[model samples]
Target: MSSSEPDRAVPDPRRWKALALLCVAMFVVNLDAQIVLLAIPSIEQDLGFTSGSEQWVLSAYLLTFGGLLMLGGRMADLLGRRRMFFIGTTMFLLASVLCGLAWTGEVLIAARTLQGASAAVMAPTALSILVTTFDEGSERNKALGIWSGIAGFGATAALLVGGPINDLLGWEWIFFLNVPIALILLGLGPVLLRESRGERRNAFDIAGAITVTLALVLLVYAVVEAPDAGWLSAQTLGLIAASIVVFAIFAWVETRSAAPLVPLRIFRNGTLVGGNIVMLLLGMIGFGMGLLVSLYAQQVLGYSALIFGLGMAVMTVMTVFGSAVGQALVTRVGFKPVAAGAMTLLGIGCLLLSRISPDGSYLGDILIPLLVFGPGLGGCYVAATIASQTGVAADEAGLASGINSAGFQIGGALGVAICSTVAASVTGAATGTVAINDGFRAAFIACVVFAVLGLAVALLLRANRPAASPAAPAAEDVPAPRTGAPVHAQAGE
Candidate 1:
């Protein structure tokens, strides 16, 4: 059988159990992204982080994680999904330990970089494994719904628990918490996951991988540091220019490589392209909103960290409910309509949140918007993901998974930078409560703009259609990666 074919005729019975394990793994990845936000002050005091440099603690992780995701995904496809996942989980565990044990700011930042690198390996590989595990129709859609909901919940859950954890324990426990979870994943993974990989090509795309990785790292670094460096400063402009040049070089390398890291023709899949666009907009809103809300609650409203987290608890609950509903709706209707509806809700939520007053209470201003927003967030994740994966070949599943993740992460960096810059512009050396609240309100309005753009893109997505079978084409008919149509990678034959 071709490597693109599913190895099993009947689905694995352990798939559901495996899905639970994968979700747990995904939870940790999502949690780490925002848990540190609440603990930044404690971490700074403890580690003696310089005023400006403390941001590196977060940037360090985001940089490496976003940079290497594509390489990580392709490696999983080439090396073995299960093997890469195990390696990533073990590495993450060690990095978490290192993070907990660090006495210096530099050491913690180094450990965070390691943590991000490992996450780069884990996220896409886990999703690729999921793509391979379930049947691609309603079964996969259902599993993705559960997965997307938990994934959304993981981010908010960090907000829910991060403050309490930091207040009761220390910031170290935030990293250390991954210890038991990682150990559990390491133990359960081997038994639960079946090994799988794509066909091994004769030559590895070393140039393509290196160039693309460098390009992504530079891109992330540019946006992340733009707010501090001054968006129009030479440093920011230089890095952005350099990133574009390197990306151009990577494209050139792909066209010439014997085995390109990302086959250029993958762009031919219109659904995948449209889905990623929407996902990018979603990412802009998701992380940006979290940061803005946290800032408004604690910095403006004068709520304690623990209290703020507790106030946001409804977001987590509603996101879970939304995921379940969105998944069910997608199965019945289609991803396009569901995605459009979700974006509409998100836009409405943002509009409501854009009107927050300086003296606003959580019950009066924040809670309603979160209630309106959470389901849309949950549903949009599922819809966009399903859309991105549609028509992708099983052999390229890891690559597609990586692209989907990269879209969100890179978009998050951009979103946060844009929102932060906008807020800073509005606040402009003003520390007053009204000034800060105005900044927060303006940021929410920015989020509303993202939602509207996302909705427009969602409308443009191709209708949901069954993917073509890879086996339909003879070996000789398979076109070269650079020049031909995609070889649809249906999960089960």
Candidate 2:
């Protein structure tokens, strides 16, 4: 038996209970994401944030979240998962406290930055613990399905609850609400979750960690600032150039390091790389749609922020619907076709929404596209996560999860920047509905391009997944690696 089989042999009955707690952690993170989104205008008014400075309130969190995720994932592997989870929650709670107490725009932005950093540590480790505890096959698959479904709810819960919370208790409650939940998790975590870590390696990859993290930060910052600063300006051009240099140095360090933070060899898996690529695009699609649609609804259609949140709830609900059916579709039709179809649906949905008019109502303009986008939105996330995690070894579970998570986090920053930049570029000397809708149309066109590219890449995931690995059992004749990454339906291959 392989080294990983022993972990499976001694099952932890408390694993399910642990999952419930982990889900709560995930729930709070997802909830926090949406709460502020709807409340941004209110937050800006209260804190005196100008429109230009206001974007930072959103981008700051994303910057830290994306930059630190790889490091966070590695830390989870080095430290214990339970320990990391606790630390993460505590930091998140403190950040929330600061955000609630914040009297200035600067403070609020800083608090949000800390919150993202905290979540970066907490988020991937939860899934690592799940993967470590559960065995592969229907059992692990089912757990992932449930996890995805809960994640969908966590993401959309803010839409359902955020509008009311912001209205009734004030915008501060969005952050304050996390206090009780975190304290409860802190109290119960030690008893509920098991401590798991990879074998301690000889030396920490300090150079590798620093360089890669710097590159990610630079990249994220470059995109975030490009819109306001002019994409071709020296500042934007220099930042992009520097990020490439720093990333190249990190790659060099990884190749030479005795123990790399990101294993250079892991990139050898085409499925892993492709899956992460698709994930990045998924990030663009998901975040881009949320921001653009919300803008059109409020600015063009004259809906209230609260009403818009509730309307967005419609999309979130559809996502849950898709995730529920995603696994079954993958099982029956295979990941490639399901994922391709899902992206196609997303593309078509974005294309349809680009037809919005000044006189359009929510039911007429927004509902159809959101409803069409819902299932694919729900299904693709789970599919991408599965595809990314397929061949990864037990030890690298956190790493895989972090990269997958980073794709979305970083994708958000890119999406906002790209959409904003594209939309803004066309608004010169133009005013009123024509200017704004012009930007929206241009941005949606970019989203459609991204969706199509993602669909094409999804096609590659099936072909690139190899038919054999040495560790794969000869008796069972699994086409993909049993211990490493595998095609979901490789049995037929």
Candidate 3:
């Protein structure tokens, strides 16, 4: 950077090691987001939480995580990626400790909110680091494939592990499990993670951040509680309307601010936008399906948490294969076809799942659809990871990554709300279990619709990378030997 400074002779071979460290953190965060599925009943009973308050344990985390991701990402760009990583990991660690020790439902909810905020900072920064470190061809593809594979399976891993941990110790152990992992990452992160930041700098858009956060909180709360509140009730409608108004204000603020939290120009890229939309669709179906299927397993089939986890694990193994194959195929056929075809397969899987009967066996009902959908979901994630990170400049890497990940987080909450509400829409005097079964079927039907819509969007997307200002293609740096031709677009196809 200076005349006296000598250029380094050796490339950093430790980059991949850093990625592995980042994945450790991400696994814990993603796991925390979903592992509570099995523990919810235990938590409600132990902490004396009402049904209403119990649901908030999950919603609060989603609200903060989805709402603050852009802000966290922008801060990472401004403050330095490594710095943000440490801070985020520390916050997450502290929150996990508190969650494990929580004596009240309110305290647990508060701790979860902090954990979500910490995840918001860490997850995008981790992705940005990977984007900046790896080239966009086979090398980047390989790394992203692994990263996407981890993401697609992290929740299932949690589900599988949650049962054993909860049964052996308690639900608190689920949160506590993050402690050692967090400390280890914090210890290694400074040494392993290289520092990078945007070439440009500007004042923090605090107003935009607050506006968007408030909007998201309102939106998430309204959606999560809408099933019980009556979706058409004035309370639900009012919150939804208010959230829209706040979001409009945030969008306006972004346009006017010299340093916007979310750069609107990124949306112009059809491939990236399509990737994000599909990511949202995945998020929606993923969380919603988990809730429905797990409920059906536990309530209807009387499966234990361990059984639920193991069932999902079978699917996770298939997911790994899907992602591995997807990474290979994207280099050959491009992300567009992989994304569309994979999403269509998932849609069909959802359709198949909708036919599940109350008396269905695991092999016929659960295993069939899980086998059908696992690889599809894995392929979708791999395609999305590549597409989302493909066209962005180094400076805006965190922002782009945040938005893509945000789609999943926000979509999950909205999906759960909608599906849960729909599933619960049975008439009076119906058995509770019957209502739940009906609800799951409805949720699967909704997933089918969303998956179909995602397939359409993916099919319509362009494969060429959108032009990014201030920097060149990320793939240009590595110069890996081309197998046949350049895989995805670089500024132009």
List TM-score per model, in order: 0.93, 0.91, 0.91
Residue-by-residue lDDT tens digits, candidate 3, 45-129: 9999975789877877888888788778777776666778789999999999999999999999999999998999988888887
* Candidate 2 structure quality by residue, lDDT tens digits, 366-390: 8999898888877887777767766
lDDT of each: 0.87, 0.79, 0.79
Misplaced by over 4 Å in model 2 are 1-7, 463-493
Clashing pairs in 2: 390-485, 391-484, 391-485
Ranking by lDDT: 1, 3, 2
Global Cα lDDT for candidate 3: 0.79
Provide backbone clash counts, one per model: 2, 3, 1
Model 1 spans with C-alpha error above 4 angstroms: 1-8, 465-493
Best by TM-score: 1
lDDT of model 3 at position 362: 90
User: What TM-score quantifies how close candidate 2 is to the native fold?
Assistant: 0.91
